[model samples]
Target: MRVRAESPGPSWADVGLAEPGHGWSGAVLAALLRRRGAAVLSHDTAAHLHGMPTPHAAAPSSLVHVTLPPGQRLRREGVAPHRRDLPAHHVGAVHGLRATTPERTWADLCTRGAPWTPEDLIAAGDHLLARPWSRRGRREPASTPEGLAAVVAALGGVPGIDAARRALAQVRVGSDSPLETRVRLDLIAAGLGEPILQFRLDAADPQCPEVDLYYADGAVALEYDGAHHLAREQQARDARRDRWLLARGVAPLRVTAEDHREACRRLVEVILGRRAAGHRIDPRPESTSQSGHDAPPAES
Candidate 1:
């Protein structure tokens, strides 16, 4: 029943009810498992199913990943099989296809041989815990920190367990993008202390802006301006936001892709300067707005 696929597209083979591709999707992987009826999707495959933040190195896989009960022999072609004991709760449906739970999938991704770095694993965890504005209009977190903690606690003597624990400690919910995660990590690595994620001033005031990274002690806020911040409309809006922050005596630092190399350095200077000046450095919005885009675009 091997044949080329057109709808889900090339590099795919149709094996009766299942269409497995080099980069087989979760639904396709689930279909393959349903045909086998004894295996559940796991590892990176399951991570994709759960919509976790994939690592930068991730590419389409040539084989579908599935886990079977211990002693179950699977001789299916195009399927990568592992013999493991999966709890019932850990096995569930994602996108109508049977796959490991988000927590289980995240844990598996942290294991040895999984193609993910510590940061990638942490970002995935953050994604799981984020309440993003999706098509569903404000989607709830797929998993919680407490749930992830329990999973890690219960899984003792597991392979890659140390890495999993390390990643868990770095995971923080409310990080809206990978850039935000990197900035947070970079600040800590640079001895700036941990910047709060999505920190807001005056919670009662809707006019008060929430920042990507907030240094409450120094009243300094840093924003990671990705591609979206480059638009003229967005630039104008950011200018207004900067003015608003300046009026409140908050030092707003906007980091664009260009500033990656010097961002931490510049940030340290600004924070120290503001601290030395005793937060009286600037109270006028007109004096603080930067020229050009919110964040300089990456070099061509």
Candidate 2:
């Protein structure tokens, strides 16, 4: 089993040589390989050594996540170990170990770039959240919410402990159901007011209820629709849902992936005019997010 180095020091050769590739320690394993002129990647380099996955961007890998004590230096010239305080719950494990359980990994990446999604985050929770803290099972409840309201708010982006709290806020999962959570983050970043989530329409067609975004009281609905909505059957069903909504004297504002923030701005304008009886509304505009390090590995 792969294990953390117990209070490891840097040099391997100084400790004494083992037969062939045999007596080398982890540090020695890395150093002697460098001496032989082979390029090596450390940290979560090999697949699934720890929960952190293959990086999205193309930078050389380092044990960038495994923190070292302040004033300590890397033995290999120019190679640096990232230094951060170890989380309290990490017991019986060496500090500066080259891993951060999935949850901790996700928390570190949020909004700081390594590019993660709500779905990836939720999928990670299955292995990470509320688990035992043995050295082997290091995932923890660092960033998720225990309740729904907090889930939505945690959906708001922050860093470290705050980011963990935001991720926890809206913990609903499944390969299929990230709609509300996805839309909320998009809208907030776009500077639009938050909309009501999971609104349901009640009428004669109780057999097939529509998952709505806006309320008829002049409040607009915003759906976190994905490409799946464009599939033949889903599109037909959406058409029917729209017609039913129209018949009830409600005007439905539809948005697709191509037109997110602009569409939201128009809808909010409509809501202000229709719901508040011609009162002018000016919603703050949001800037778009940029591509980050975790763009997923390129096809070889």
Top candidate (TM-score)? 1
In order, candidate lDDTs are 0.69, 0.40
Q: Candidate 1 clashing pairs?
A: 22-61
lDDT, candidate 2, equals 0.40
- Whose lDDT is greatest here? 1
Q: In candidate 1, how many Å is residue 135 off?
A: 7.5
Write candidate 1's Cα lDDT for 1-300 as tens digits. 232365453222332123323555534554576677878888766765566666756654566678899999777777778788888888888666788899888887788454688878877877787777666665777887777877777677787888878888888776777667766677777777766666666556677666777775577878889888889997887898788888888888997655556656777777777667776322123322221112212212
| Cand. 1 Cα-lDDT | 0.69
Error of 2 at 109 (Å): 2.6
Location of the lowest summed lDDT over 10 successive residues in candidate 2: 286-295
TM-score, prediction 1? 0.79
